[model samples]
Target: MYKYLFFLTASAVPGAALAQDSTEDALAEILAAQDATGPAEQPADNGGEQITIADQLVPSITVTANGLGTDIRNTGQAVTVIDREELVSIQGADPTRALQRVPGVSFSRNGPAGAFTGVNLRGAGSEQVLVLIDGVPVADPSSPAGGFDFGSLLTGTVSKIDVLRGSNSTIWGSDAIGGVIDISTRADTGMQGSLELGSRGTAFASALAGVSEDDFYVGLTGSWYETDGFSSAASGTEEDGFSQIAVGVTAFYDIADSLELSGHLNMSEGLLDIDGFPAPNFTLADTAETQKTLRYWGDIGLTYYGADLTLRARYSRADTDRSNRADTGTLSFESKGQMERADLRGEYRLVGGLSAAFGYDYQRNQYETSFDSFAQANIQGAYVQLGWVLGKLAVHAGGRIDDHDFFGSETSFGGDVSYGLKDDWRLRASFGEGFKAPSLFQLFSDYGNRDLQPELSTSFDLGIEKGQRGTGTHFALSGFRRDSEDLIDFVFCTGLLPSPCSPGQFGTYDNTERARAQGIEAEAGIDVVGTLRISGVYSFVDAEDRMTGLELARRPRHFGTLFADWEAGFGLSLGADLRIVGDSFNDAGNFTQIDGYELLDLRAAMPFGDNLEVFGRVENVFDIEYETVSGYGTAGRGVFAGVRAQM
Candidate 1:
């Protein structure tokens, strides 16, 4: 099952390899030669036990940190991993809730679940981040910023999530000026299911089943969720509603002893009741408006393993369609976007501690809207990296060149190094260059600008860590800085043709901004006693426009999370977590202020039988009132309960 995971991710991530049975031993020896931490065994898929702080400290293999499945502490980048157990303990369909606990990460939403949600990493804007699911890039090409919306991503059958902070365009191509978030779904065999009911008429149910043979494996998963949410307007009285259904399939088949084929498909549909300014008032108020969305993405690939070489070829596609209707059921707006990519990648181990990884890829993006007929763009890129290890030191250096339909050619370079020290302490440093091309909506839509250039950035970070996972004490601290230029922003027209703007244009896009983001991130965990564990994460970020020196909108300067879990008697466990966010400006101009807030959550679970467990949680125990976006209503106190069964 783990080998199949490598097959699916290797092509997309660029350095991963499909390992044979003895590959683990070889990898351990390589690590031992470098004097880095040893690889920890993978955890059970869906155990009923609570995820202790020490569980997160365990040094697991991370494919996102580097191109290969390197030990987390052996990589130079700041990385976090949330496994299946932590995801279950978080206990919600929304994964962002758990993501917020990671250092150097924050999020904001217009309202409740199913609303427009955006995530920022290390002070970088949401648009600068790259998101992938099952090795497929799922950002919407029709969006104004070419970014992924986290609102619709539910934790149904997901197994693991990897977050790599800092610029990584050398490995991930484009839109990685900030970082990368990789989501992996279940590919292991067996059966697992969960059912839950919550406040505000909320209900959710999900099921996953798989079968494995001597040479092949196949899995199926499905989920449904619905909720009567509160109004999106802060002072509105009406109640909004949301519902969605998702389904997926994963398969892997072994052809020869060292050859395999793999494929994955996922589809979802959602309907959400949204509140908007209505009629003569035109202020922030409740109105009868709704949105319908259909999204699906998939990929198919083949892999081959040899004596010292591993190769993979794959093709993937993502599509999203959305429509909005008014109170009278009249179509107000509609849009559709599609992204398709094909690539081939290879990994070769030359000697004991020397290796080479290379890949080439082509991507096409197209979008159509009710107002604008259609637009399309294409890009071709190739990259190569060299990894070397010499007693107590390891480094990876890479570069990429890309040709865009409009922008011609651009190149990026990056490298990272990790040095192991005495007593389980490691020092790491990295530097990277990144770029993001203009989105289709920004270049060809009604407000488009043909003269715009791609956004560019340079990032650097340094950190030190002590102890690996499963250890009694573990901590990591890092500082990073990113400088960006040629950022695209909307410019309102002065209504003067041939002078202030294009004719008949109300607004246009232009490269008009320069920005900088610098921050410090710290994380620590400890096993206090035999059955108690504690963990905490904190970040301090200063994000601003270089020209105006004004803080970016909705990005807090200080934010952190604290967690505690205890294993009680009789197969019972209890946990508590607290989240704190400092004040910040609501807009880029620093005109309005959004106050700071804190939330406390409590959870508990116990085994009912051999394969059955019951769990419950209380969110926002104090019913704190706050808004991430101005005038957007947020959820108050809520309680939820669920049951899980696994075999």
Candidate 2:
């Protein structure tokens, strides 16, 4: 299952349309950048019937697996693609809500919207997963774990998300011990916008507009969101408020028939009211604390498309500035993080049914905080993959080598195979090795240690599927296992760390943890009839600490989703989603328990003419009470409604 975040917008490039008939066609159209020479041939249409929302909800093309657009069916790895249609259906102001629908994935939020959020894939730590936004790694180097915050990512600004589950360091490099999340912003040649109002005094608005000429295209997008949220603390009286503003611009120009130049810029600023432990009790409680964040990322690139070869070179950068303030308006904490990267990559179609893809990237990460001085690290990585297809069999093999300024050289390998059988059945298997380097905050902070080694992991999976998405009945069963060593955790100054403990230090980072996770994921969907569809997913994960033989924190053993959708008469659609989660522990020691819960949501959308639509949803229909994290408050029943326009 794939998931993504908030808001809506318009096209930025001539070939950046979200609606494409095929992966190859979409890539060719965007890369060509102009119609002076000719446009890519369109696929043959089947009658005059328009594509259904169901078809658009489950994307079939993947770009994260091989670093290029390819049919998902050909890839043996476990992958999920959530398209714009699905994003819109969820109608969540925060994108993390939609991620719950995916199997083998779970998330915990410290409070309400704009709070600290962490996502786990297949039982991997949040920091072990790599996140890419528009092809740029955007993890905050200033964070202790160097993890991406899902809470900050809103909807509408994102159009599609590709999730590859399992260790994938061979293709994505460090911080991929769990998996990878690739996010793409909306792109289309049109004007579109949406406005929504929901419970808790929540409001959201977004707009996008762009034009495409014969040789050039440019567009602008923006969104604003604010909400007077419920108390973040389980025992609190004051309401916390959150607000954000985001904007983006994209441009492309055709340099020649086979070459193009492109550029993009995006920025988001957010203010969040948080809860903190105050004096007196020094326990989890509400306090007048606020966090302000500003994030910016952009890239400029050149591409060359040949008959049998394609090449791309790009430069990109991501920066994040954050500050926390207390009730007295005094700054409590401040941090800055930056990453600059340059890369060159290409793919060549060799003779027969074999192809090769190779790339090299160099990046520098810098982090600074109020207490900690500026610290920086450099990394250089190179990788290559080979793919071969023969009749009913497809195979992909790849390797990556990364050189970190402090961690030395690390090599990773990954491969997968897919084989077809009769009656539209397929079998797939994959194996991968992954590693994660220590973060700057972990290596240079006041409680840091420089002698920590990188975390290492190995993972494997096998699956069998019947039928394909979009056309009709589709079901898949997969099993996976992952083992991790040298996991870095905070250790008190007990004199057991690899490095000498400094005086007056409360704790230091050390690589002294190991863990294992194994699970089964099953998903099935069927077109019960021409106008109705039903789908369900279930995940069973057994994750535990190797040393203590205890279950990992916040990782549930059972979770699943049951969903149904109906295309009603008069251009109206109705859907229902039921999410179930089992009990879980809140701490590594398994001292506290979190009870299981179930939630149901109902949604409806109706089209008004060809350019407008109205939508609404009833979240937590039963007003279920639960907590993903112990001592935190979860949202109650809420109603939200919105209007959308496109041209």
Candidate 3:
């Protein structure tokens, strides 16, 4: 019978090739670069007819993330999803280059008034990563260093962005250490809308209508953005930066039939212009830093389920008022912050494919920064999670315990496992532990250092996967290792009219008995024909510092990205992208290094008659000159054209 069950399941799986070569070789390079009768596909806007995100593994219902109204493939971890039609087919001007299309995600630009953009996950760093909205915690609790500026947020009513890489610190606790990114809001179904205008002095627009019969639902959004000044010379022509505005609204209802309710509100304003660079004194010139940012957010939620109980509760609010170099009378600064959160979670399924969840969360972080001191801090926490499943095997565990009257208590935990070995083959494993507590501007910020602590982690992973269904193809291969302990370093602060102690003075943000990292990751998704779609990802990181072995400042050892799309039924559509970057070193006074680049992008989509649609794009399409940091040279050979309408 099937060769004795395929040789008794290959002799009871021994070593299973120790995670490497499961054959398929990136699915034979997308079925040998398939063709098999192309064109006839166009479904992608989240609910592409039958749905996608690669079918979310089958199963439904998810509530405000991790509060677990359950069923998102029973939540076993190792998740990656990006919808909203792949987020406007990214060509960047914002939203962190649309998250660099995942896979070892990386981004950094240090300047341009949007002030710093560094989001790294997998290869960690960026304050060990941890960002969530719609589920609370939007980073920056007087953040003196813990990443999460998220490229000045506000993607104008975003839709989806859930990239949970690793070390989840149990169920998301303590900055999750190097993982947890959930940016949600956008489920208007229909009555959707969008508008546009562009190029350096750009004019942009956004809108999504709303209406839902019975069990009420509401939606509304507003956006506007502007940009000017880029004459390259490394963007220094007496530099300039400005323009931005945002407004948002969301609502959901369903009082019974398994009760449901939701709420959200947003506001944003921006005006920035920082043209820095040209320091190291040559009679100082090339300066400009005048910025403003005002933001506000709110949320509320409740959910309940049946067939073994499930529940959730949430409340959140955020406020930010920021100012910098206030027209530079010499040097001036201002920062204001406020965050409030109340979380209550629960889950239960105790039988068969087991499940469990625990709750209780509260946070209050206050801020007041102005360089020479005016700080704040106050944090609180609690968390719990447990899950398991049989039939295709699955398991997950979580924990979060935190306290910070001022950089004190901390706790984190995580676990995961998966197996399906058939119906397309699958196998996975995980181990996680993370922590980071010490902020108030690094314990008193503004050159604060009251003897800091808390920064620990341990991680491990393994993977394998194969695709199924109507052929096409799907693939995954992985490897990772992370080790860190008290490894939070930043020393060398001296002051004497700005000499900040010259020798790691107030620079006491210590913690580094050891630090390490290792990696290898790959991804592939394809459908290749009759609708055409292809995806790719690659990452290789060494990440360093076992005591200044270096490679840790702005880390980068290798990266990758390749994309393709073609939708046709006659209306026509085509898209392409290629990005590869490697080589990096900057930190530890290496004298600067940031070179190793390649970029290409293209797009074409037409439909101008049924609900209007038009497209044109060519970004860096061989713009070849690059630098993501170090003299910051990014943006060359740019062009954009747009039109998208839906009725």
lDDT of each: 0.77, 0.77, 0.59
Q: Could you tell me how far off, in angstroms, the CA of residue 299 lies in candidate 2 after the best superposition? A: 0.6
Tens-digit lDDT track of model 1 for 209-324? 87867667678888888899999899998888878888887777778766767777778888888888886988878888888888777888777755567677778888888888
For every candidate in turn, the CA RMSD to the true structure comes to: 6.2, 6.2, 23.5
For model 2, residues 113-218, the per-residue Cα lDDT tens digits are 7777788899997888887776667787888788877776777767877788999888778898988877777756689999999999999998888776656668
Error of 3 at 489 (Å): 24
Q: How well does each candidate superpose onto the true structure, as a TM-score?
A: 0.91, 0.91, 0.30
lDDT of 1: 0.77
Per-residue accuracy of model 3 over 225-311 as CA lDDT, tens digit each: 566745323645655555666666667565765555666666777766665435475332356555666767666666554435545
Runs of candidate 2 exceeding 4 Å displacement: 1-59, 495-506
C-alpha positional error of residue 472 in candidate 1 after TM-score superposition, expressed in Å: 2.5
